[model samples]
Target: MVFDFTISKQGNYAIISMNGNLIEKGQAIALLEKAEELTKEGCSQWIIDLEKLIYMNSSGLNTLIQLLTKARVAGGEAVLFNMNKKINELILITKLHTLFKVAGSKSEAVEILGL
Candidate 1:
């Protein structure tokens, strides 16, 4: 299925809700880039809600890492929420699970952001 991204506020933090697939050279990057732009502008805390995501390729994983880097460099933080087991395994294989703060729920993530 095609992907759609929706961004909104969960208190003082930003939530990026993702649906569908995240693949190489796909709409996923567009969404990630948009989040990057926001981070570069100093929007620090992020919750990447992936409850509706069914697939995520390596490139998609890279996009997420890059976004986290950008956010951190900009003195912010990026947290992931509701990622499925398959995607979690991918992150583990890539060793990015250690680099990113992952939460089981959006509320948990938001609380981590101290929001």
Candidate 2:
């Protein structure tokens, strides 16, 4: 299962919609790179839509953490939305639910970001 991503800019935010499995190391690297690129482009606010993501391994989780960390370091926020049950469970088990900003829908995330 190849991981795919689409990035679009909306006002001051960068919205990334992800699909497929985000298990491969290369996929994680690619995702991190894209996030970094967005950061450099002055996109402080981000919305990562995971409604289409099928499966995500530990690496994928780490990738998200990295992105979130970067956003915080830049004095910004990264909001995740539409996470599947498995991903949500993993976040809860890892006690990372507190570290991430989660929203029920993309519109809600945008609202949270004040966009």
Q: Pick by TM-score: which candidate is best?
A: 2
Model 1, span 1-115: residue lDDT tens: 8878888866556888888887866666677678777876668688888889889897778778877887788787999989888988888899988999999987799888877
**Candidate 1 Cα misplacement greater than 4 A, ranges:** none
Give the per-residue lDDT of model 2 (tens digit) for 1-115: 7899898998889888889998867787777888888888888799989999988988888888898998888879999999999988888898888989999998999999988
What are the lDDT figures for the candidates, one per model?
Answer: 0.82, 0.87
TM-scores, all models, native as reference: 0.88, 0.93
lDDT score of model 2? 0.87
Candidate with maximal lDDT:
2
Q: What residue pairs clash in candidate 1, if any at all?
A: none
Lowest-sum lDDT 10-residue window in model 1: 24-33
